[model samples]
Target: MSSVLYQSVVKNYGALNVLRSLDLAVPDHMFLALLGPSGCGKTTALRILAGLDMPSAGKLFIGERDVTRLQPRDRDIAMVFQSYALYPQMTVGENIGYPLWIRGMPDAERRAKIDEVAAVLEIGHLLDRRPRQLSGGQRQRVALARAIVRDPAAFLMDEPLSNLDARLRLTMRGEIKRLCQRLGATTLYVTHDQVEALTMADFVAVMHGGELQQMAPPADIYDRPANRFVATFVGNPPMNILPVTLAEQGIAIGGTPVAIPAARLAACRAAQVVEIGLRPEDMSVSVPGAPNALPGEIYVVEPMGNETLVNVRLGGGNVSVRAGRDFRGAVGANIAVTFDVSNACFFNSAGLTAVHRVNSDGE
Candidate 1:
């Protein structure tokens, strides 16, 4: 496993600009998720790294070696695609051991490596089965086993869990993260699901419209998004961004006085209009005596066993607050939600973020 760096990478298909000049780095042995919507070029970026696609313009480096012109096989990388991409004619054992065999490893070593990975991946019992005989999750496990057995420079996974059911996807997310960490395999994974990105990767790169929106640790991306897009895209049920105005002294939501700390207010003097980003989990169903509460009416309640999400309509927009499982708010109920000041984010109307600046390491 090695450091993967993409410098000034660009990809275009005739008039469609799939990837604008992009620069990203996956440090040695760190799992990084290329996360974004379907057409945001995350898959393209993985293909470029895997040598399946050539960049229109850029320099790509795998560790200290430049591999911009290398073929897929020439680069020491194994990829697991969303489709599993198993050889239908081959049994699971054969598919998992194929990479080692092709690299001309001794038969005994290949068998040993395949057995080791198959055992760890819990796919040993399925080894004798063909792809058609195995279930979706089992086939995916085989694909991952093959990639792991290769002992390649890096593993590239492009939405490898997308085809599985929710439970299987969740199961594989933990498996992949644990497997990568145990082997210390530098991995670049691509997925549109924010949960997959946040859960499996040490670092997450959020992309939009063929551009890298922000790159940071998952916690940072969730707590301090670089922009409105990243804020809205990173969290579950999405972070709520309310359009507000900033005066020289304080902030106002819908022309009503909202108490913002003096220091934060001063920091926002430059932006006349801004959006306050609040994660659903950061806002509570205003506990008994909490102040700085925003008034709203309950619009919807969603219960997921462990928690209840209460969507409330503010004057202009709406925000969702994550309530405890015991919370029993009825629809159309009057409520006041309180945002945790220290945990909230703010961005100017231009969409560039401001909250990440206040408590940065500079603090």
Candidate 2:
């Protein structure tokens, strides 16, 4: 149970820079996910924390102790890689007890610790099975049991479930989250999968181009993205970003009128053109006469069993709207769409920073 912190961590390989002054902290017993695409420096940052890669500059700490110059073994951290890394010749019990054995624990004590971790991981029944005799999930459990057997100060995991099937990944997600909660160990997870980060971590640090983009809880990152890149990345269907003109009469969407409040209009006075963000589920299709509605033509309709996703063409771009399962709108049909003022996100024309939202009554 230790907190992890990195300050001004910079990593460079020759002339190419991988991380730019990266600073992050995770509280004791908290799970933080370092989430981004490949080449985003997330894996590099994880390796630096694990003491597997040395930072070109900056400081690293585990619980109040500055460990920038510490070796991997001296950092008191356990790491789990994507490949499982289990020895084919070793049985499950042997694999789980190897860490204790290498640390010079007595045979009886090593076996007791192995039995304890195996029972906690629910792999006690498979103690005698080799890696070849176990399923992928079972093998992964064995790998995790080995890591936790020593009770290290923290755990560093690099896409540990990336090789599993979708169903298995979902199951493992729950298992991993439960295991961390039960152990109360500070954990750092690196992955490109947004679902894994959102479903498992206490907080998510979104990164891009070796820079920290946004660090927030999953719901805030989804509802109020700091920038356009985050807005488009975190959601499944993604948020629809459309260009609109801010005016006293409200915003103009494809030559049609959509009324925004005077307060919001005042808040966005710096730009004549602003980018408005709307989530697929936030917009609804209606008849053409609703007040504050923007007229559009449906280009496609996809029935998703539980609901329907309607792609409507507004001018040259298309906007996706999530509708009820019973929605029967067809392509080529004219429809009006409206969204709640409070639910929409505003951004400057460049879509760099999130614009502030002010409601009606000039408040």
Q: Cα lDDT of all candidates, in order?
A: 0.87, 0.87
| Candidate 1: Cα lDDT at 105 | 89
Model 2: weakest 10-residue lDDT segment is: 354-363
lDDT of 2 at 272: 45
Q: What's the lDDT for candidate 2?
A: 0.87
Mark the regions of model 2 whose C-alpha exceeds 4 Å error after superposition: 270-273, 356-363
Residue 153 accuracy (lDDT) in model 1: 89
Expressed as tens digits, the lDDT of each residue in 1-363 for candidate 2 is: 799998999999999899999989888998999999899999999999989899999999999889999999888999888889998899999998887888899999889899999999999999999999999899999999999999888999999999898999998999999999989989999999998998999989999989898988887777768888888888879889888776667777677767766766666665544788888988998888788877889999999999999999886279999999999987899997888866777778676645633324443
Alpha-carbon deviation at 320 in model 2, angstroms? 1.2
- The alpha-carbon deviation from the true structure for residue 28 of candidate 1, after best TM-score superposition, in angstroms, is 0.7
